[model samples]
Target: MITVRCFAQIREILGCDTRELLPAHTPQCAADLLKVIAGARTADLPKPLLVAINCEHASLTSPVKDGDEVAFFPPVSGG
Candidate 1:
């Protein structure tokens, strides 16, 4: 199983802060994880979404395995 956490606008969009998915329900990459979490709303997700694995920044294609913690959020901007 994997733990998925959504923050900021992402959490609002998905209507949940965290979820747990079995490996069979999700593929092996961060991209696939996003698809599973977003489902049909995938297209409505923010463009250029940021991803992280176990607290380290990662790309959409980053490999994921059981027990990994994945986080998704929109890019942040501050002055």
Candidate 2:
């Protein structure tokens, strides 16, 4: 199982800080996992968000390995 963490508005929306997913196959990259999660939670999420893997910012295609921690958050705004 891989660990997925949610932060900021994402955490509030999901109502949980973390989640576990069992990928059918080893995800080639972070993008792959995002697709899975997005599809799974489509009903709950309607907007785009940012994702990080292992505390590092990553693109959708970023590779993901077993036991990696993935975090999701909304875009930041500043005045």
Candidate 3:
């Protein structure tokens, strides 16, 4: 299983903080896994959210494995 977390506005939008995805096979990368999660929650999610793994910023191609913890959040803004 892969652990996925949603934070901030993303958490509010999705109405959940976390989920466990049982991939048929390990995903090749974080983005791929994101797609799976998005597909599962299509009714509640907006497009183009930011994602991270283990509290570090990550890109679409960031590799992921079973038991890895991934997080997603809306884009941050600052002055």
Candidate that would win on TM-score: 1
- What number of clashing residue pairs does each candidate have, in the order they appear? 0, 4, 0
lDDT of 3 by residue, 1-79 (tens): 8899988877886677889987556447877776676766755666577778888888768888787888888787869
Q: What's the residue-level lDDT of 57 in candidate 3? A: 87
> What's model 3's overall lDDT?
0.77
lDDT of each candidate versus the true structure:
0.90, 0.72, 0.77
Where is model 3 more than 4 Å wrong at Cα? Answer: 40-48, 77-79
RMSD of 1: 2.0
Model 1 lDDT tens row, 13-48: 899899998886444999888988999988888888
lDDT by residue for model 2 over 1-79, one digit each (tens)? Answer: 7898877876776677877987556436765665566566645753676778888878666777878898877776769
Better of 2 and 3 by lDDT: 3
Which runs in model 1 stand beyond 4 Å of their true positions?
Answer: 25-27
TM-score of each: 0.89, 0.68, 0.71
Please report the candidate that would top lDDT against the real structure. 1
Q: What TM-score does prediction 2 earn? A: 0.68
| Alpha-carbon RMSD to native, per candidate | 2.0, 2.9, 2.8
User: What value does the lDDT take at residue 19 in candidate 2?
Assistant: 79
